[model samples]
Target: MATKTRVPQTIDAYLAGVPDPAAKKTLTALRAQLKKLLPKATESISYQMPTFKVDGSAVAGFAFFKHHCGYYPFSGSVVPALAAELDGYVTSKSGVTFPPDQPLPAKLVKKLVQTRLAEIGTRAKKLAAAKKTLITERITDAAVKEATGHDWKAWMRVLDKAGAAGLPHKQLVTLVGRDVESGWWRQSIAVAYEQARGKRVVGETATTGFQVGVVRTLPMTAPQLWTWLTTQPERWLGPGATLNAEVGGSYVAPRRRGNPGVRGEIRVVKPGKRLRMTWQPDGWTKPATLQLTVMPKAKGASLHVHMEKLPDADVREAMRERWSKVLAQAF
Candidate 1:
């Protein structure tokens, strides 16, 4: 009988099998550092890359090609500042690389990978935040005109007439406070309405209410941050939404057929800046608005979120707790 070769179980053994000597050596050094840092990690090949499985999920991976060696922090969203440090190399939205012959920036690589592991600690908190924000935005409602210190009903009528009207972030900031926007009052109203109505609206209708509040600073830039928030329906917002950033465009969040708990949509959008939207609840008179403001800061940017037409006190309190958690993701 012929003897079978034993498959590699350690990163070192895996690297030793690579064809190129230079790539192999660099991978050896990289694997050595990762082993030292993550003693609990198990090495394996996943998606054809050398993956490090921490707990159960593949936390990181690496591979060597002809021109460069690539390192993948699976959920690359963890390290917000890593992008700048990787400026000299060729990079995209996800992975980073270093030339095989050049000395590895071992320290930075370790820091980036290690940070991803740390993020797993807060996954529960992040999910809870997202859920709570979805719930609070739909139930509340207040006199939009009074809370915003503007005759908003009149303003709505104006937009209704214009046929392509959407509120701008700058104009909103002027209305609510130094930090206000067009829909700042809407989130509050939706929350209140939900409390009074005692029903969920997300997956049942054209629009639904949601809870909203300010989000703390995140590690990403204003542009990236906005993209992430508006695009959630595409990722985890259940059946997802039809997103349109155009002025007169419409956003639709269809319900999961026969299921009433999941949905998403874009109620209003003011290109690159302000947005009004609906989330998991489905069906109602109107959806709450999410207004995102980006004020440039020294290190990054200060994000002020204005949620308009939110609901009652109970809804407000619930939403605050929820948003505190959801906002944590940005950092």
Candidate 2:
């Protein structure tokens, strides 16, 4: 008669009790992979399986059965993204199974771990954004008055008298900045004024819009990069390009030969760190926002471009390619 084995209470004990040598080896390799991928995660035995957790949430788990090993991502969506790569394996909504004799490939395991980590990161970002929204929504008239020395009604009247209803989004925000001293109060007032006047405010996405962004590390300091962006854009853009270098200022890149020039209004200007503007090419139906952020690294600086509210997919891709070319030339 065969001896009945007791279920182990800890991850180490569980791995030690696996009777089949091949299964034990496979499990050990997987354990090592998980540990390598998630050095900060906690490992434990949960539900008679080995589980890895981060921030007290389960990110991944695994178990060995008689003939197969199972990989659990703790997410129903994670496996579906890699469906093509998992063609030969058995999969369900939350996990995948591979034969013990044929251990999961190292690359596939790495991809699985990465996907789980990304999912966790995305979830955390959403939660933080939601919390920020909640806090913003809780701001009251008293709070605005205390911060900016003016109540919501007073700010509304000021905006109404200033003809904010007729102004564009960028101009309205600039106007708000000038009227309210505190940055937080300024944003709150602008939102309230827009809501009262039926004007669209920030954080609302257009129905037919997309966003594209790219990052590049340049061999220069952030201040030097800022100078390049502001003073010498014509080197990469083209001759005759001009920038005003202040909020609410206009910029123009003159047409050369047969090409049409670009025009925009600077909406934000933070020295050596960030710049944001509204971009409209000669034939574009609507304007889009372009933001540049610079961060100092160990040796140089990293520049990032984020363009949003593009009208269509084609325009977005075209803009991406154009920016890629521009960066290639600039660097």
Candidate achieving the largest lDDT? 2
lDDT of the structure predicted as candidate 1: 0.54
Candidates in order: C-alpha RMSD to true structure: 16.4, 19.1
- Tell me how many residue pairs clash in candidate 2: 0
Clashes of each: 57, 0
TM-score of each: 0.38, 0.42
Clashing pairs in 2: none
> What tens digits encode model 2's per-residue C-alpha lDDT throughout 1-331?
5433355667788889887888889988999988998899999765447888887767778887766778877665678899998998887655788877788999999998889778778867764665455423567778877877777777778878888887766677789888566776566676666656645423344232477776778899988999999888675556667888799888897764324578999999998899999989888867888998999999889889889978653345445545643664576
Which ranges in model 1 have alpha carbons more than 4 Å from their true place? 1-13, 76-80, 128-331
Candidate 1, residue 52: Cα displacement in angstroms equals 0.6
Tell me the tens digit of each residue's lDDT in model 1 across 1-331. 5443344554556677677878888888888788787789888764335777777655667776656787766653543457677668765334666788774587787777767766665664664554566433432324454455434345434434543123332332233343235454444433333322443333222132344465466666677756765666433232445566555555554444322342335556665566655543454344455555655555666666655445432333333433432453333
| lDDT of model 2 at position 69 | 79
Misplaced by over 4 Å in model 2 are: 1-5, 135-331
